[model samples]
Target: MPHYKKTKIPLLWLRRHTSDREFMLISSVLVGLTAGMAAVILKTLVHYIHVLLAYGNRLLDQPYWLVVFPIIGILLTVFVVRVAFNGSIGRGTAGVLFSISQKSSMVERHKMYSHVVTSAFTAGFGGSAGLESPIVVTGSAIGSNYGRDYHLNYRDRTLLLAAGAAAGIAAVFNAPIAGVLFAIEVLLTDISISAFIPLIISAVVGALCSKLILQEEILFNIGQREFFAASHLPFYVLLGVLCGMMSVYYTRMALRVEELFEEYQSKVYSRAIVGGILLGLLIMLFPPLFGEGYDSIRLLEGNNAQEMLQNSWLAFFGTNEWLVLCFVGALALVKVFAATITIASGGNGGNFAPSMFVGASTGFFFSRLVNLLSFNNLPVSSFAMVGMAGILSGVMHAPLTAVFLIAEITGGYTLMIPLMIVAATSYAMVKYFEPYSLDTKKLAQKGQLLTHNKDRTILRIMKIQHLIETEFQPVSPEATLGELVEVIAHSRRNLFPVVTADRKLDGIILLENVREIMFKTEKYDLVKVRELMVKPPAIVQYDDSMADVMKKFDESGAWNLPVLRNETYQGFVSKSSIFTKYRKLLIKTTNVA
Candidate 1:
């Protein structure tokens, strides 16, 4: 990215003059406004691009434009990312989480606009991905940079980062409550009640922006349909189970496809071309796979599956209800592949929209199939809407967010009971198989994720590599006791590592073990350092996770352990050092009093 000289913030004086609580509340408004505008711009950009492509003479004349548009979109996105951002940018929501966990919530300023530009290009031209994630990233960067510029602490910075995301989510869908829940559920799970105010203010402001500025056609809305019937409770629960299963499929399939693309990350262009082509083929077969698929969601919710099928190229084979059911079922299964391909191929977008799309299709297929085979009359629209929540809950592991977001979008809580049942069931099912959400699974594996488990969170944040102490001094294993005595006199530490000439650790020498021999200086030369030293109870590898190091410490019952890598000496990792860092991080990471 392009570099710019840092400038002073005018709000610094206001922050210094006002109490933190007051300043934060005021800052929330500003963050919400900015983040909401970012959402508006991104959505507007995608909207216009879509309009131009749909109506433009050249694109309209091309019979297979669906195949070519997505490729072109990926090409443009790849070009921008490679040429403008130097071949890399942030990794959407997971990157945001990493910044909070490891980077002290200090998101880069470039991400404020880069994701907006890139995602618009990716989703605008029919790339099968969601724009919500990029929107969240952009909004989060806005809040983070604002906090950093105004000299806020880590706690405040993280809160604002989440607040900004809440605003973006609120602004895009015009669902203020869901926006707040998204931030709380997805970004800051263990936040205090006091922290909710800023998030609430941001989401409200964001919803206002969408209400006044965004056109109805651009919003993700389908006002409530018929009220929920008690008779449909069983079907909703079954849909929940289906959503849970589909969610598992979505997470696993996306993970595998992304892993396959990891090999081509360095070859951006090659991956983009191949991924773009595959995504195009899928979108051609199933037209609903294009962009965010919100239109198809509306179609499904409106009981217009016939219209939805008629728009797809697959309809050429047949339009029987069973065929339609199969086609819709296929959409649910293939959406993950399309979305992952869109992103892995250099397109910038998120899984949020795709999850909703898949959930809608699954819900529609399930309800439709049952209706065709039996006398039971199921509400297809309600099932479609609730399905969005189920998949969202399962895929993102945010049940509350899923329930409220759909409820808000529909402008009523009439389906709240069913939404809860499906969301809870789906979430419970997915949780049984995967402990971490799809966005955080890899980070958790790499020991970089901060979770609700306070112990793990603190440990994960503390890097043992930085805690190793090298000043304990080293002694040559061949050195005599007299040499060791002189070395010990200058060293403050009670323990010393015995090393060979080539800097390999043989064992450790404790001062207490050699105290008797050192006093008898007359025969000091006869006592070699090798004979004085003994094997340490345990050794810590240089790259061991904090959890592993702690386990070693507990088992060894030692205050310090020798750190080694490839049999070579590094340094000692003391329990004191780890405890010290853990205490400090615990303070730094806690967001409430």
Candidate 2:
């Protein structure tokens, strides 16, 4: 055999270092503890923001206060977004998902930092979005960054990311069980022995941190309640169906609002100004639209129908009860739209809590409608909560997370049966209508595959033939960087194949290397492919399965890899091409299925 350098991949490096199970366990616990602390800080900051926003809303009740508060809020938010920190948009859990799905554990550190700070400002200033997003972003980024700093392997890095996410949820809600469920359902998408220990520890530590600080002050303080009566089964089913429809409508409206904001970003404050005016007017007419909707839920739960009705959009319009129902339902749609616009226009906030608020409010309205139609005999509050769970879960596409979260928040296990019934039904219905959730849509945009099975091999979906770079331009290592740039500009390859004088594979020079050389100095004329070629480049045997090829590609973080046998290069594999072919195949397979 010819002399060969012992190339070490990051994945192999990790396995070699982590030889003992106990050491790994201890390391995971430490990771969990660290993640939990970070999550606590993140959650505490968002809560403070929420509190300040509440004060701002109260100020909106006064004319002088109204003008000053909005200005202050907007000014503070701008400082956070523009000067103090940028990249704060998508700062929360959704940001974490976006980062992990597209960039893996190598997220931009500034982006993560900016995300936390700006999200706090946005929420504090009364932006109508959720808080959980920032928490997740902060935790996951910290964990992932720690892994990066320690030079952990890909699998360990992914685990740390998951631990951060789980810890964030636990810290935010003080719900360890819910955190685990959310991690498995939303983040990990699988429960493995390797992942479970760290995630569980992280969640537990996070919950402990929250308990030590917040002392169980949940957003909604729903008192203990009896189980749903058998007589309410029909109503629960109806509520489930209604929630399903609402969930689909809510997701569609939110996405559309985001799209609208993106389309009109050039106008900047004009869209926000207009939205702010509308929100102000809506709040003046119906105070329920004032903030994040938790207070609205509290208002409804207090059963002060007279006060709610007195702000009489209901009575002035006609039948009081029916009119109240209409107003509440309309408000749900408005709030969802507002939340979407708030974040889309660079306001920067969360999504999960606001979604819950919208769902709860919708459920409350639907229950009233059901009661009104049924001689005022339906269990409106119960169905309201049930419907809220369903709609919220359906919209987020995180049924288990919503189910257990609502349960833990309410301190009511009796609601589980109804919650499950509504959650599953609503999720199914929404999925039938609108196939993509917010996270999934972002993944689709980035050309990433979002699959359900852990065992599923990417090769099964991707075709090998499609991944080959077939423009058929072979360059000798003696070729200058100027020539390489010309070739790159003229060709579609992001990577170039470096061949020796005999047209045999010598190494590979990626576009990134060329760009670095061009930017570092005006020495492109002096540089050659051989100078920039990365030695010990990933090589694959032609006989390897597609699965093996995929594993290599992921492990190497290369968009292209070489197929070689006995010093002979056969072809190259491009990740983008593989992905494209996979998408086509997916569409075909789905049609057949």
Judged by TM-score, which candidate is best? 1
Judged by whole-model lDDT over C-alpha atoms, candidate 2 comes out at 0.65
| Prediction 1 global C-alpha lDDT | 0.90
In angstroms, how far off is 300's CA in candidate 1? 0.4
**TM-score for all models, in order of appearance:** 0.95, 0.71
lDDT of 1 by residue, 519-565 (tens): 99797889889888999999898888888999998998999999998
Q: Which portions of model 1 miss their true places by more than 4 Å?
A: 1-10, 56-62, 451-454, 457-463
**TM-score of candidate 1 to 2 decimals:** 0.95
Native RMSD of candidate 2 (Å): 13.1
> All models: lDDT?
0.90, 0.65
Candidate 2 lowest-lDDT run of ten: 584-593
